[model samples]
Target chain A: MSQSDYDYLCDFLKERSGLALAPDKEYLVDNRLLPVARRHGRKTVAELIQMLKGPDSGHLKVEVTEAMMNNESYFFRDRVPFDRLGDTVLPDLLRTRALRKKIRIWCAAASTGQEPYSIAMQLDQRAELGGWRVEIAATDISGDAIERAKAGLYSQFEVQRGLPIQMLMQHFEEVAGQWRIVERLRNRVDFQTINLLTDFSRLGQFDVVFLRNVLIYFDRDTKLDVLARVRESLAPDGYLLLGAAETMVGLGDLFKMVPETRALYRPNVAPKKPELALVPGGARVA
Target chain B: MKRCLIIDDSSVIRKVARRIFEGFGFTISEAADGRQALDACVTEMPEAILLDWNMPVMDGYEFLRALRAMPGGDRPKVVFCTTENDLAHIARAMHAGADEYIMKPFDKEIVEAKLQEVGLI
Candidate 1:
């Protein structure tokens, strides 16, 4: 709660999660970390900060960071982006990847699993994707988030947010008064604990990347670094979708914003000449 | 193809919803309010009904109770669609023999997902 304590908390969060917390956000620190601090038997947040400064605060640090990191998610949180993903992005990717018969999607900061599962549900609906191999790699910085994402269970309140009742009935089963996503959907995504501040190239290339809504916490430089690293994993012809409020403009030049669209982007590569399609009569069509 | 009756006062919402269901190859019908929806149902019972909560002639709750009492009404799967998502309303709708529920401002995926949920598609 003191100036130095606030400084330590802010610096540590920025260092670990790239979240630039303002000095005046003591109330946020109090609200988020107080319960976490109490669990460690610390009398006050100051005591928790003191313990966090200790060399042997590995578990305590994980607890603190996980507590601070928001893990809110639901099936299809935002409708427009998913509609775009289903309507345009996947159709284009399916055509491009037809030769390979394989598609890889990475959902960065896949809190709890709804985003990735939402993607899986969309893919499942695509009759065009029959016999193709699809891999959705879902990752978050919090181990707790990854575990919960893996579990595929949601409370009534969690499912209430933007989740269709049909999805709840078809894809989920009531288990002990909570909804559990069916095994078929639960198996579609591979969950991992990934810290975006570090390298993520080892996760391999993705035909489509969803980094929605997680960028607001980062400072300008961190956003650039993160986008650059994300670019390393995105296929040259692949697409990246950001949150409605988040934009690639002035953040980095690894991508160019698509016009008249919400947040769809393609990699910033040299423009290729248009390939005309021939009509049945052999006339070239633009 | 299985038929689906979309009950909502808004023409735009009905059109938007019709496209989502028709994608699954279902025959689609629309009604402006609960009264017209009953008339549509009396002629031919649809395999599924996407009922909206608020309307001018009759609201969804009253229609649902009336429909369940009608001859052969229980055969069709009914999904209550509404913007009022409070737990009390949800409980009330479910209590009135509504099989499922979807919120307003839905698109293709949400519609298809609900249909799939009820095993209608």
Candidate 2:
């Protein structure tokens, strides 16, 4: 891709998804947009760039963005956070929010629905949550991902990734060399296409949000902007889970890191001066 | 039989490691992320830990630090099983108290040999 074409693509992506593409990311843009180009009958990446520049290519831009956003995901990804959620966090939240009698969980950027479905399965397994009104809302930037999430079909490779055998047998049915998440578990989660950069007011408030592993693509300003909006949609004392490498330090004062669990964050209801700790690799540990 | 914990984000790697260790008559426990591995280490007390470098919740580097800091001599010998083969990566793994390093796409015999060399078998 030419420098000007790359710059135009970056600008388009930034305006749509709040994702800033650096000059070094040309290879990534080319690799991701190839299929989109082919689908549009364009012979080369250059042709696709020209198509994107034309007035009729607005839909193609959305298609390219969606294709880039479809990330790899599988059931029960990164078991510890789920274990923590099941063992310590969920129990605590249940007890603390007893008066509300309802719990709202949102999985933002829930690619392929693994994270939210896993959460739903965990809640279903817990006999104590029987009486509570649980609403699980899962959203992804790509409509394709949301559709797949709704289908609840997974391949052997995906099933073997992180799913335990017991849970697999219990919550899913084998279908022609694939596993389909059972209707009961699938029904608990509502999947929709929602771009985090866009308005989230329609989604309403959430008690717990899983926004893991998606922030790495954004620049510092976009990260801050996204988190601020998340904070607005979050309930007081709501929990936010981020990827392990991601931190709220140097980003903004919207949240505080929960001790011991590097991935867990809680909204900063009361203003406290930010304290800096030097974690290994010079990454800030809040 | 000795107990082994395989911690990697990739199911393919985990399955391969499980089969390799099971072939050597070792009981295998698996964790897909670093935090789960730490919990399994505490609960199961495996004789050795086979760790991967990159993961989402907690990477292998942080897991190594946490494992080394655990109380008592019960800390198991760790062998770094990762795709990272660069000298800097090796140096970092060693600095984090890794006893041995095994590169990815490992054959069964190579992994068995590494295990035996570390006296895991």
Candidate 3:
């Protein structure tokens, strides 16, 4: 690929998906776009870039953007957050939302549904959540990913990654030599194709939002913009989970880190005093 | 050192699992079948056990039951590593007191993840 075409793709991806491709990442562009070029009957990535620059490249642009976007995912990708979901996060939400008897969770960049499905399985294990309405809204920028996630099917290799065998046996059934997540768990998640760069207010307020691992691609401004929008879509007491390496530093005052937690944050509101519990004939304790 | 017993009929799998677990600082021991594994356990109980389902002398389920019945046997974190992918086999393994399970043809990453899940690494 030529310098000019590389520059064009870098800018295009940045504008469309908030993917800040560095100048030195021309090799990444070639590696990802070459298969797209072949699929489009183009001789080389240069030809694909030329077509991408054409007047009627609207659909082609979407394809290119998605091809460049990383879709890496696995069951319970990071174990800590899931553990926290059961031990602390969900327990807190259960107490806070007991009267409402409803909990909404958004997997903002739910590549192929593992994160959301993992969350669903975790929620199922919580006996206290019985009779409560739970909605897991999982969305990805790639329609292909959303469709695959909706199918709930996975390869042998995919199922083995970070998935506990008990959960796999309990939740997924073998279908045509591949593992398919059971219909009950599949129906728990509502998958959709959504771009984080665009407005997602239609997703409504969520008690918890998992915006993990996808923010590393964005520049400073895009991160700030997306974080602000996420803050808007979250409930006042809702929690936002970011990637292990990602943070809210220098992104302005949209969120504050939840005390004694990593990569977990709540809205940037004034701290609420802890509720003290009192026992009969005993002193109050926090 | 954190001791782990690798029980598999296949020497290749045992070697591979040894290499991976060794890198994670586990002192590894090998056993060919479930009977041998149970005897090894009676001598000195390991902190963790990587068990295989279909062995010639004694299968994983029988061995698991025997081990759990023995004193200090329930202390080891038993992880079943086998080719058996069906629900019945998996459910039985868990029911027999196996802490975790892994499908066969596991690589370093999968082993690492499973070990991490069981808190070995």
Candidate 4:
């Protein structure tokens, strides 16, 4: 792939999803999208690009983007955030919301259902949450991944990664060698196909949000815009978790890292400033 | 030290598993087959046994059944670490008294997660 082609592809992805393809990602584009190109019957990547440019190629375009956007994730991808969630975050939220006995958790970029399902299992494990309603709302940029997330089925190897054996037995039932999350827990989450670049007010406010690992795909400006929109829907006292590798340190303090915690943040209350205004619903969907 | 038994035919697997289990604060023991594993159990029972499916003398299934039949055998957590993915095999293992299953080609995190599942760590 040429530099121009990579640039064009990056622009294309940015317009559809808020994903920014860095210039150094030509190798990644080659490795991840070559199979998509082959499936589309293109002899070479150049031909694939040309076909993507053809009239009424919207379907092909969506397929190609979805192919490239299938990021890798596992149940409780990192242990610390989840530990904090079960140990501190949820407990505090439960106490604060005890009057209403309601809590809403949003898992942005909930790939393959692992993250949201993991959240559900944790909430159910707490006997204190017996009568409380803890709603987990999960969304992904890809529709196919959202459907898979809704199904809550996982392969043997997939279940093995980061999933505790007892939790697997308690929350999932094995069917035809693959594990399926129990209906009781699987039904607790509401899955949606949402582009982070779009209006999320329709989803309403969240008491807790897990926006882990998805910010890296976007450029700096896009990250700021997404965080602003997240703030719109985030409760003032709500907690947010980013991936361990990710931070909001230089993002103008939209999220303030809580003391003695990694990736756990509280929304930094800032006066509405005109300079930070990012147009909500920035990109048009294909 | 938390005692753990690594029962497998492959020396490499045993060595690798020993390292992971040891890192989790376990004093490791190895057994070449189910027969040897049973003899080792008789000598000193471990808190957890990471058993592989296929072996020369006695396979994991037979060993699980025999182990379950032993006095106080059910006390230890038996986790099947194998490449097998068939439903029948899993059902057989569960019926034979296996506590959990972790697929092969795993690393330290996965091993630690499994031990955490069985409440060992």
DockQ of each: 0.11, 0.03, 0.60, 0.44
What TM-score, computed on C-alpha atoms, does each candidate reach? 0.72, 0.69, 0.91, 0.84
Q: What is the TM-score of chain A, computed separately for every candidate?
A: 0.92, 0.91, 0.93, 0.94
Model 1 / residue B10 / CA error / Å: 28
- iRMSD, model 4, in Å: 2.8
Once model 1 is optimally superposed onto the true structure by TM-score, how far is the C-alpha of residue B31 displaced, in angstroms? 21
- Looking at every candidate separately, what fraction of the true A–B Cα contacts under 8 Å does it contain? 0.12, 0.00, 0.62, 0.58
- What would the per-residue lDDT of candidate 4 be over residues B22-51, giving only the tens digit for each residue? 888999999999999999999998999999
Q: What is the lDDT of candidate 2?
A: 0.79
Clashing pairs in 1: A166-B114
Model 2 per-residue lDDT tens digits across residues B6-107? 999999989988998899888899999999998887776888889999998999999999988887324687888887754467678887888777766666
lDDT of 1 by residue, A212-283 (tens): 988898876677667766777999988899987778666546788767778888888853323332222211
In model 2, which regions exceed 4 Å deviation? A271-286, B1-121
Top candidate on DockQ is: 3
Off by over 4 Å in 1: A270-286, B1-121
Clashing pairs in 2: none
Which wins on TM-score, candidate 1 or candidate 2? Answer: 1
